[model samples]
Target: MSDTISLVVAGGGTAGHISPMLAIADAVKDEIPGAEITAIGSPGGLETKLVPEAGYRLELIPKAPMPRSINLDLFKFPLRFIKAVNGAKRVLKESNAQALLGVGGYVCTPAYIAAKKLGVPIFVHEANSKAGMANKVGAKTAVAVGTTFANTGLPGEEQVGMPMRSNVAQMDRAALREEARAFFGVSDQNPLLLVTGGSSGAQSINTAVAQSLGLLADAGVNVVHITGRGKQIMDASGQLLAHERYHQVEYVDRMEYAYAAADLMICRSGAGTVCELEVAGTPSVLVPLPIGNGEQKLNARELVAAGGAVLVDDKAFTKDYIAGHVAPLLADQHKLEEMSRAAAALGRRDAAQNMARKIIAEISSRSTSGQEG
Candidate 1:
């Protein structure tokens, strides 16, 4: 009601963070049609390219990666952090941001402090089951804390699910099944497996798949493999591998097609992927990243618990595991369909719109109170 809603979306270094941030932007824009959204990201982070590509203005701040151990970088941390906060403050003032929506990351810490300094309402969404350090700090005084998982233990936690792309969230795989399969050159009678290692690709996963290609093909499973950029599986001759049943691409621009066409998936279990699988109702074999704070493992917990996915450690996901576990699962059409139903039940298709309504409601409440006062 007070002109147009202005928001600062903070967080992005990877697709995990940027995707949900964009989802929030898309939902808010859908509601207000002319809402102003400015994204704050670190200069070298993936957001530099993605935010601008999505038609949102990108504001870069100095990277403020937290040092785990005392090192030369630790000495430089404080000064860099202060500068990042000051830069965030400048963006907030310039945009006159009424509310700041942050999906947790290194970038959000400064943005959170900056938004609080200016008395702008701060809303945070934590996508992992284990909250990141940045989000824990912001949630201390956030207007509200929305979470994709129930047990993050953050203050004021609300299980609002993930803010996912509308195409994924609203996908009716059953309706699109025929078209999607045809688009991927997969037949309805044959099992289809979608394999990906995310944007940068996971070497471990790629190697495992490289070894399992012959086995998968023998089982009559068609594969659409996304090898990340420059991670394509190649033959002994240094050319891309050739297989009649295998289609390999560096990346997928429209993932909805991949999701709809795939009966099962083998991929990393980042929070974003877990949620998308749930939305698509595609059962998967999830290999949680071997690093970080074990958040990836935690992110896949509920889905695994619900029988939607099978969890394997990065090291244990070898060619033997693929032959003994994955190939058999793909052959079991009944079990795959059952897992798909369980996964679908866990997806909250309205997360973006739900979070959107909360942010807009917060803005309206402030305006109403100001007028009444």
Candidate 2:
């Protein structure tokens, strides 16, 4: 065996999957500086750019979404999966991969199959409260499984929390408040509100925030609205709305700034967002996406139960709800402070290091045992 062990990380299709994948990859690199790391993702996903930009070589496989119903696509599913598995096998075999790490996505199923066939040790991280189709299958045969939430329904999962960006995991909101506020061009005196809907933006969230802007302004709250790409809020004349306290950006490269700056957030409660909110200890009024097997609601359940956050129905999250709900929350400093503290209590600041160390220990043990044999 070579001195360096080769590893492959598999996940993609969306930022939710890609972000944690990269974080885990970074952690793995830290844990084993001599380890050779490669990544596997679908061709069209965000990983195409993000993976390479992070300085790791990437291998592309075709996406193989599990078909839900009887359709022509269902007929095509088997062929697609086989091709993806073949693609994954080529990457792993050529790299002589010793282990495989996967966060759930369309690409994971094939990677899992390829790794199993090659006798590579498999580790899986499931970031949602409920396992997706890929993870539900991957976890059954994986050597070790990790989860962001308890009772994720994946077999033999250990709650190592979500592997998140170091900036988020180590964010000191109180200390970074002033700098974060300045970065968003907001006043530290006023409570800040952040509204986001991920990379593609949420139409309903954008509308509600736009309609409630005046009410929020009256309550002396400043706003930072991330309107997704090509989704900026515009006036009747189709010009981007401009207000002294209302800052609009289609995307933010440095979301830690926004998270640190805001007193509250109104956004979907994806696993990544929920984990980030806890890590940042930022109070949020969660608006779970009204689709996708109700996983978002499950994602928010623990935080809401802990009094760190609140949830609103997708349809009910309108201007009126903003006035009756959000405005009052922003006004009460004591309440906000309490919620912030509650959120902070649930944060796992060392999750990346924890998961990384586990990977290294497990892989190292395998190598040692093999050499002795």
TM-score of each: 0.97, 0.97
| 10 residues in a row with least lDDT, candidate 1 | 180-189
Residue pairs clashing, model 2? none
Against the true structure, candidate 2 reaches a TM-score of 0.97
lDDT of 2: 0.88
lDDT of 1 at 241: 91
lDDT of 2 by residue, 216-294 (tens): 8888899999999999888888888886679999998887887899999889999999999999999999999998799
Per-residue lDDT for 103-143 in model 1, tens only? Answer: 98899999999998999999999988999889998999998
* Minimal lDDT window, size 10, model 2: 1-10
Reference-based lDDT, each prediction: 0.91, 0.88
Candidate 1 positional error at 140, Å: 0.5
Question: Once superposed on the true structure, which residue ranges of model 1 sit more than 4 Å away at CA?
Answer: none
